[model samples]
Target chain A: MSEKNKYQNRRDFVKKVGKWAVALPIAYLGYELIQKTSAQEFVWQIDPYKCTQCGQCETNCVQTVSAVKCMHAYEMCGYCDLCSGYLRQGVKERNTGAELQLCPTSAINRSFIENPYFAYTIDEELCNGCGKCVKGCAAFGNSSLYLQIKHELCVNCNLCSIAQTCPAEAIQRVPNSKAYNLKDGYKPKES
Target chain B: MNKKILYILLFIFIGWNYFIYGQARFPKPEFDSGYNYPEYQITEPISPVWEYIDVAVLLIVLTLTTRFTLKTRSRKSIILISAFSLLYFGFFREGCICSIGSIQNIALTLFNDGYTLPLSVLLFFLIPILFTIGYGRQFCAGACPLGAIQELTGIYPVKLPKTVETILSTVPYIYLVLSILFAATDSHFIICKYDPYVGIFRLNGPSTIMIFGILLLVSGVFINRPYCRFLCPYGVILNWVSRFSGKHLTITPDICTNCRLCETSCPYEAIIPSDLLQEKESMVKSRKKFIIYLILLPIITVGGIFFLQMFSENLAMVNQKVRLAKELRLEKENEIKAISIDAVTFKESGSTLEQLFLEEQQILERFRKGTPWAGGFLGLSLGLALLLTTINRKRDEYKPDQGKCYSCGRCFEYCPIHLEKLELK
Candidate 1:
């Protein structure tokens, strides 16, 4: 071939090599990211039955405020005049009073439905996940109130602090599909 | 017009009076006896399977769009696909798990080893950029719901001045850097937090964000994808990749006839005019300016680092830890009359103030290290923009600006040569 053709061929080869040099790394990085993503096997969650209400969720979480929050099972509630979840153990009267409240933040809002029937609702914003109410309810009432990690608020930490310190071993890594274990018929594994 | 105004005023007066009277008629509830609880509705989260389906649909749409844009160059197909994307990606999906917001997820994952990124998020972030490298930004033409929403509303877009457009385009780079910085430092996802159109897609959000969404749509009527052009951080990546794509959309399949009929076709003013005359003196002057800018680039970058360091405290405020630290400090000093809820919570948790201070210091250290990188990136971008402006290129015919062009195929309808070729075929 002539001098011009040889130079042109060399330039074309360089251009092709340069294109691949940029393309290959990007393709490889994308593949690596995908691989890393696929290998993510666990999601942080709470086992309702195993939880002993140790109150570690209040302090041991990596998040400044723990992702664990109180969820009310409205169906399971008895709507009694006096609720174990809302009241302190020994009170003079079964009326709503500042001193008689079990929750430090007064998160449980009690409303009068009728003469003897009153509804107890957990005000989520004020709940600190200390499990004082859950502990009180399970000890005396229908075991309606339980602790579960709110997935929306959770960052899905790799090593959960609450899990590490859980005396009951209630916190466990589950599949992402079953991240939230509700109070309805869900059982925790016996350790 | 005067009568219409009087009628509107009269209607408003009657409505106001009616509302006042209606309020007075209803007796207030006894707060002591009965407390009304707002009905809390629990929304079921969208299933993981559906998210995977959305990803699949996205990939399929992107491939089809690339084919339609580069191979067929069919405007009709593009419009049809864009409408489909709007229905599925915009209305049905409610615009979450989008590529624009996924930048934060990727940044957070890279910085925080504790955080594991979901598969769908990684796919959402990478797919469009990978596609852009091979086939230009066919994704921008029709696949992206955000782009499609604004594109459909671009009815009578007014061409902005080149200088103003260039300056506005720099905003996305700064936004991208800030978004990554905030996400990496575990502050907040600024991109997702400030997304104007996601609120519109979901049909409810903070009133301020909803109003901002409405304003963006109103502006879209004459601004031609204002968010995509001037605010989208993901678009910056697409633009860079599309610049070097092997195959890209062109106005005509055949050679140009030097016809100026397609001159005013593009609403975005992306068409570059032919440079027929040689101005040697101006070129020499620009070359000197380019050299000067090259010399000043490092100095500007170093200055940016120091400037950002000065505002480290303000930047660190974005992190909750830093803000809580300050609050605790003030409370201890008696400077704050009321103890904040977060500070109260910290004190009650049985953790020592020294531990809190140590955590705050660590977070501040992260910000100190991260902000300088963001500043350096911004400075580099500025210098590069200046360098690009000073560098002159020779063009013999009207051509599309490779980085700015969306491959919309509007100019094809105005090209006589393209029309003639279609007729002959």
Candidate 2:
């Protein structure tokens, strides 16, 4: 009976010792990690400057519809009535015709502001992120129309599929505070 | 006329280059009319304060689960908590930065100083392990939404053959080694990449993963927690810590009646029955086998290191940057006939080939150093598992297997003693 009691006591001591021995290192790592944890939360976003309008954003998203949407940087818009962004390349007329518009979904809403200026606001609901308008806009107009991962739409996947297959490596992990990388304002805001 | 057309074509070509490089060809227009430009609209990411609430909620749920499983021994209460966990943690939170995936974050932060592990994520990874050490795998009982979802679906649980179960159980240890190895080398987190439940929780993912999630759920009805039992890398760590738990859930509240009713109750096959009837092995032969395995462990580890080291170069190609470097190098050397879009992008990015080659070499160096560590850990685990099978604890009653039991309280209902106590209450 005494021998059994002593054996149980020894087992208890070893078990207790083993528990803390493993726990301490893991807990210490947790403490160290907590100390090192950064205040800034980084989320995936498109780097507008690096983006080459490869059209992968439309197809490669894990979601049925891509989280990537075309954003109009009104600050950088040329506001031309004959905007290449609105009308296709080498179009004779600048009317809002289905055949003439660069956007496949006719997402670009062009409103006449003045004699030669038209405000192009994108209907995000309709935009497929094909970057057709962005490509045309960059060719002959101010590259104001660009694609960004809409926070409202994006599920914030850890490793974004679009980022993985992006030929340009345009998708970057930007501080969440920076939010959208607008064409008017890029992240790490280059000169 | 031809000369004139050629001159105009040259002008157009020059204009196109200017347009591409100029960034803004038709500059911001000056509007004489009073027209206001719309303010830039950008939506915010999910608030960080909510993340803190999630951590606090995780702590509360884990505490409740531990108490219910260990002290109360009520399967009904456990079911209630698991249902809530499935709704809140699984469906509401959409399962990002899960405890399972957090293993990669910790691994990555350990090796790469640049990557910061969030406090909430660190807590998510740590609290469960701590709770598990104190009270055996209470988290797996109901606190983990992944397990909760599986538990809920496990209506017609089937016990797998012991030999097949034992063989499949080694997968998580290998997964843990590979996940840590990938993270330490700054490669992508395969844990999150291959997670089956997150897509189900979010209701969206690649079609392949969605199909896999559906398949897992379908099989879960019969096989019972196919992932938790076989694939979860985090389960390997939790199982190890749980073996030394201060307290663990018991099948019977008091002395076992040995009626064998509770023996088949555990859906996870965690109830180890009495070994009194099993044929006993010769003591001398068993002892010698134990010593042989102990001696074989180191030799296996060294052999594993060498074997994995041989394939380090091939494994290094998993990095996207390394693959691109090889492609661009081949294109430059005229080994590849066609230039890919990635090669063009790399060329235009202003980074020289020398710099890319150097980065690739560094990444390969990391893989060379890291692969051996993973292989050694796997080999050691294999040796330990083999050794464990040879030893048998002489028990005359049924009991929950410490490392394997999820503490779900399923066996409590089967225990007539506990049922009488509940009836008295």
Candidate 3:
């Protein structure tokens, strides 16, 4: 081909490539949207119902801090005077005492209830999966407290060491839809 | 005759050891298998066979590129080394897209999410970039498996019509975009998924994809690794990153003399000729085209992606097996609840514990389903598009930039200029 033809061909080729550039991504996104919308469910998701709230998920994760943490079911609280998951020594009569506390990290909180009853709540950042309070409450009180794997801190490792080692075998992978709140008590919206 | 027999026996033994002996069948990565640490974990190690191939290819490319700069050493020893590495890496060890892992990590940083970047990404990106800046894309000449596949193929390299090549080359950029988008969306790395030759090297994966593998191999035999030139999403990324890569193997200023020999020698057409005569005209036109293409491309591409994504949604539904697992999980949970209810009724039910067990299983199932596996398909398709467009060159001759040689050394090995350089010395 002559030089003019070569230059013209190059220019035309560039234009064709340019046309495809416009065409291809639109084609791809079209594929993705079709695939995503048609599917019954999104591929990446967290199941709240199957999580056991075991604290091993805290330290055993690959990231510096485990992504798993405790979430609350604010709706289920009985609001008792003697809160089991929180401090045992009620302030006033429910005043504080170290021995009375159920959590190692002081992550659980106690609030006043009707007459003698007291309300209880958990602080997630401070809560690990040790399940001391869940054990305590399940043994002496209503089984209200539970464990969950918070994804923010979780590395989503392919194989979870904590899941491997959990004595309860409570650590489990979950789909995004059924990912949160497996317990009967108050269910929290978990990420 | 005895010597010939012995040589044949030796070749057979080497080929057998290289191809058959240590074949690895890597399982699909899953959440339940207990192997979650991301760093240093061999997600995809270069197989022993591939290590040899990579080395062999790298040395040959290096020799060719360096021939002009250095002495014209005997070709025999170099050929042997090149052959050895090829056997080691290509046949025995199995090749993988290691560079793509790095690209994924880099893309991951854009999304503020749970995943952290791996160190390997930085290394893979950096090495090629550093090399390209100084030497051009010599990496494509040899070091890259995709490139190596092309170089080793003994086809009469075809200079695609510039129009065709221009159309084909843009595919890599599209591939890069899709790869990044998929990775950003917490999807699988598409480049690694649909790799045509990986199955040949690794000898396992879904068999259907091997059709493409055959296509790549046949095409490699035809002209070069068509995949590497027009389709490699990672190559597209590497080319972009390599542009800013620190000093790389370049055609030395004194040596190039504007001779067009190196241009013809390049199979990938990475060597952009310096347009001294029509530099101003080309630049202004190029700039104008760039603007026009940039503006029109995304609107069309995004529209296309949207439509295709919608179309494929139902076709790509999760397997029945996964659905069954999810169903089974629910049943187990119900069984546990039944046991707990029974326990409350008769004090004989192991229901609470059973319920706990079932719930745990359910959670595990959820994690499994959520993992990103299918994300890379679109990216792979896009990369293929780029490769198809980019490799077409209308120019009758080849040209090399002053910089950006990867020291892969293909030109020196084949370039008449390098041969002349050797004769001068």
Candidate 4:
């Protein structure tokens, strides 16, 4: 009985040693992995400079309404009375009720600022990221209106659906703190 | 600045000086009015705090899973955990907190220096592996959202033939190597592209992915975790580690009576029945077969490299630049369409055909450097699998195969001794 107990004790000792031999290295690996990782998340963002207004951003997003929205660079805005992004080219009359609005959803909100200058704001709720206004602004006026992925709306899939179909491949992951790829290195002042 | 001077100024600012302005061509409006630049709000990503919470929840769930697998040993509790996992990790989090896809991130990190591995992803990848080494795939039993979703859906799973099961089980190894190759080469994330359940979690995606997801789920009704069994690259690693697990669930709690009631209880074919050694090969014959397989290993590996190298260009075509360059080259040489849109766009982009060809060559060069490793890994796995077939282990009683068993506790009720033990308790 004494010899049998000794044998069992030895076997248990060996097993325990083997278990730790595996477990300790795995624990070390976990520690190394944790050390290597950053707490700040990396997320998908669209580089406004590279975007071609291909209209893929509007349709290819996993969200039904799309996460991309028109972002305005107020510093870059010329603020013209005949804002091409808000109004279609060669409109009969430049009025609030004009039928020549370039945005299909009429997401661009134009308001009177000082004389001959209008402040154009994008209502992100309806913008749909179509890039129509972006296309218009790029072609006929100052390219102040651009498309950007709204972080709140973006689900950030492992592989962005928009990036897959983006003709210019403008979409990419950027560090969360430096998320936005605003034009002219512009950042909107946070309230 | 006047409109004339503004006309030539273009914004080419690359980084970090918030006041830089250029690119609107028209003169900046001189507003004497006191109106300030309207404060715009850019919504931030879901907080990093949520990531910590996710990690906490994952740790809690994994701990619960470990306790349940080792102590409680109840399928009902496992099912409850699976439900919670499905709703929380699968639906609420939108399935992005994934261990399976993290394999690519690791692969990307191995080759791409700029990529930063997130704290949550590394934890998600490592924690389960540690648990698996100790508890025998307890993570797969209920913690993994992917496995949970499929486990819930497997209502009438039928056991596949042994040959088919063995053949299909090798797919994940191939997928792992290929996905790593693609990620290392910066080609594309094929694993994410081919994920079957993410679309279902999001409720909307590309049509092909959605259809594939739906089809995989419908087929999973009878296949019992088809994706987990056959395609999950992470599962391959877990399977390997669990093979040496310290503690694994046994089919019977006590001595086997040789009644064989639980023989076919495992739909996953995890139950290893006590062998009569009826088909045991003679020592010399098995040794001879093992020797023959050992010799074939290098030949097969080189053959894999030779075969896969032939298709390097085709594999390289998955890169968009390479595909476009091929088309543009064809168009330039043949003058097929008078004005093809792609060619026009290609030319207008200020990139010459020579540059495009150079880029394509660089991508192909990357493929040339990467494909041999992928092919060699695949061949090595196949060769080892062939070698493994010749070796047989002796079993004295019916028990679950440690690596193959998911530790789901489904076969527990089939054992009469376990039922008696429960009744007595």
Candidate 5:
């Protein structure tokens, strides 16, 4: 065999090996990613049932305003004229007054629905996840107001500060698939 | 055979659309509220299973695209595949978990050991680069939804001057460095946050992004793949990889005739004229300049580091923790009239101001470390670009510029030699 032909064959072999060199690492990385995902690891989540409405979610989060937001269960809410979630405990009137508001941010918007019912909506942008409303509602009325981590806002931190300080052990790792546990059918325990 | 393939692709496209649009009926809620419910709720967190499906689809599409680009080299087939990808990856997927945005995920995973990126994000990041190394940006030709959207809207592309294009091209490199730096430090996903087309894909987002998307589409009418050309960080990586591609789509199927017929055919200005070779004296001068530039590279890098160090406070503010710290400080100084929600929330947490300041100091230190790295990388890229411009290489015929050419096959039709080859086949 000629020397040139041998060199040509070697070049071809090197080219073939180069292709595999690139392909193998990528294939291995893809496999690793798949394995990691399929492992069904735990994701950060909040248990509404166990939550004590301590307002730690507002302060303990790594994010500035906290990923935990007060979600109102409209189905569970009675839409009463005198909503415990919206008004302070010692308020004289049920009317929408700035001073009578429970939420420090005044995030709760109350509207007249009927003669006796007033619809309440939580403005998510303004609500600081302080759980002041949730505490008020759980104590005096239906436990419709609860805190859940908005997954969109959450970075899914490895060590959740809120979870660490939670008195009721309310915050726990859940499967990524069922990260959020809604309060749609939640029945508050009798105090 | 090509016609059959096109028909099959079209059929799959229609079938896929039908499958996506066909939703199963669910029972109405037992309790009805008087208030009108939103037609669609907030985006549900994507399940791991769905992520797996997206990865599988991306892999299949990438493989098919590579095969079609290398084997058939048919413009029509490429267009059909691109259109299908546009519908499936762009509209159907709603542009989430995109390769362009996945750069952030990969960066975060690399820098932060605690964060585990999903399988789909890894695939989305790697597959395109792998494909580019093997087949020279076949991913960009059609498979990229971002590119596909721009390509579709590119009706009458007017070529910009080479100088302007060169200057504009530097933006992506700087953007790439900044995005990676930010992501690595847990600052923000600026790439995903600013993705103009994400709004268009989901059919709703911030009005600012919506307006930006509209403006980009409008510009696309006269500029070919504006985002891909000037702003895509992922494109920077692909371009780097494609420089060493084993096989690439040639403008002419056989040999170039040097007829200059297809010189202006590429709207992207990816076609290189054979007259770029310079005289020996000019080459000598350029070589000298290249050496001088090489020596200045490190100086440039150091300068960049110092420049970025000056803005460390500003850069650190991208992190919410850092921003909160600053806000709290201002509130303490009585600079702020009302206590911000962030400041109030921190005070309510019972955490001490000293602790907050300590945390803020640590975050600032991280930024101090990260910004220099970003600046250094930016400097290196600038130097490399300068070196590339200074170096002169000989070329015999009009050919597609390897880095800039997306292998869209637009020039294939214009090449008589390519046409003849097709006819013979």
Candidate 6:
């Protein structure tokens, strides 16, 4: 190759390297910007305080099956043997029979803590928001049977179909702060 | 045929890879009831195939550039590989945070909430600006997925009429400025929202936006990736950054054998054949025109935007498409009412059903208005201006604009001049 051509080649090489160097920061920053902003998680939760356990949440949703499921507040249970929520009317003792239990699926566990005192714990998998137990519990015992949303299956459509159809107008939209509060007698303070 | 099939298979593999990765790495944003639910949205993960395609394109380009620099015997293979890589990558991955989108996005984000800019977003703005100042439009040549796609697909290269090219190139700049102005004034990045190709890569976003993207893809066959060329906000950034990229894709005097082979290679009509170049005293006049255009471009863009904003209320009222279905429905109701019918027959028609039908039509109309063209004349005029004014040449000048360049390095990789340089190094 001619000397001039060699000199030109050298100049071009340096220029190419310089271009790569210049591109480094841009490529780095571009990669970072794309990675960071693209899909950051947005926190989501449903407020238990506003849910009426009205059962509409389970039926009226757009999804094949409603994503909303009831949750048990096990800690709040008094462990009473003659549980007012579980025992049928005119019954004095807790029994494992279907007629005695308010839950259609017999999902609620009735335990004898002492004579005439009973404790009840709810099984969530079988609890559709029928509200049968909640109504029974609220009327007789402490209103411990309440609704909480299970987010695992919820599609979270923009305008909730279930919330719109709720009869008692109980499913109120709440912010992320108090997502899943238990409906066990704890009243929220006004901001 | 085999090569095309191979290329397609490669493309599918890459796309599938991205799809799988996107599915695994980034799930759809779950329902959030917080302030961040819809606001601080998580961008869905893009196709995993895009990652592979991007790498493949860059590598292929590098290999080709190396071959061109070295004056190697196997240069054609390298170039072919590079072309294939870019095409597969560009087509399957699509483009996002693209220089065009980025420029518009950053400018608007900055102009909007004075204090709310994130550090990452700021970095996006700064890097592209610096690149444009130094390089040229490397982003358009390399990093931009849409550009890469177009470059690959432009197999039967044909130059558009100069008048058309001149008109189209100016549009992006005007769009950039307007996007910035609107963004500053609290408007969303309309450019990004309407970006057609982004939905292809991300798989899902707004449905109308995706339809626009499909239009871009179909149009890409005839007009090249028009978005990257004329309408991408990120292109503005790449153009700026490219100025600062010291080593640009330039058509130097030495590389000129007066042979117009390179002209045939450029689908963008960026390259002027030697006969055309030497024959024209038009160069000086063109330069002068460019200067005048630079000054007037801003004025027209800003003024046009102002005019549009001023009449926005009226424009909204005039978009008859928004109310056509509803008006039609009401008219039908009145017509039905005018017809004196028996109560039993009237009940059979079902007013409730009609109302539901009306509601469904309203929803469909809402979707239509959200289409990219819904911005109507404002978007079209701006896109036209940028495309018409922008001038770029390869061989005689391989100057890729920085703001427009995604730093995909396709120019550096594909430039015959640079490829020769790579061999000696």
Q: Best candidate, lDDT-wise?
A: 2
Give the DockQ-based CAPRI class for model 4.
Answer: acceptable
- lDDT of candidate 5 over B213-309, digit per residue (tens): 9999999989889999999999998887676678888887776767888988999888877763434437779889999999988888888888878
Q: Comparing candidate 3 with candidate 6, which one achieves the higher TM-score?
A: 6
Best by DockQ: 2
User: Which ranking of candidates, highest DockQ first?
Assistant: 2, 4, 5, 1, 6, 3
- Return the lDDT, model 1, position B269: 75
On lDDT, the stronger of 3 and 4 is: 4
Chain A TM-score for predicted structure 4: 0.78
Residue-wise lDDT of candidate 1 within B175-243, one digit each (tens)? 998888888887777786677887677665556778898999999898888999999999887887777
Deviation in Å, model 2, residue B216 alpha carbon: 0.6
TM-score of chain A, all candidates: 0.74, 0.83, 0.60, 0.78, 0.75, 0.61
Per prediction, the TM-score for chain B is 0.86, 0.92, 0.54, 0.89, 0.86, 0.51
The sequence of per-residue lDDT tens digits that candidate 4 reaches over residues B315-363 is 8888767778888877779966535434555666787778889988988
| Candidate 5 backbone overlaps, count | 0
- Separate DockQ for every predicted complex: 0.07, 0.51, 0.01, 0.46, 0.10, 0.03
Worst 10 residues of 6 chain A by lDDT: A36-45
The better-scoring model by lDDT among 2 and 3 is: 2
> Compared with the true structure, what per-residue lDDT tens digits does model 4 show for residues A134-177?
98888767788889999888887777878866667688888877
TM-score of each: 0.74, 0.92, 0.43, 0.88, 0.73, 0.45
For model 3 chain A, where is the 10-residue window of minimal lDDT? A37-46
lDDT for A80 in candidate 3 is: 48
Candidate 3 chain B — worst ten consecutive residues by lDDT sum? B37-46
In order, what lDDT does every prediction score? 0.75, 0.84, 0.48, 0.81, 0.76, 0.49
Q: Write the per-residue lDDT of candidate 3 for residues B63-177, one digit (tens) a residue.
A: 4644423333333433443444455544554553245444654554445245533333344444554444444454554446555555566467666787887777667666665
Weakest 10 consecutive residues of candidate 4 chain A by summed lDDT: A182-191
**What tens-digit string does per-residue lDDT give for candidate 6 at B1-425?**
99999999999997796453222222222223321211111122223344334444544454354334223324344345435544444334333333354454454343334323333334435543553445445334444456655655544444678788767877776676556544433333456556666556545545667787787777777776677777876665455445345544444314544444444444555443543344443656767766776666656655655555554433333222223333445546775432222222233434454664565455444333332232434554554455444442222333323234333332333446545565666
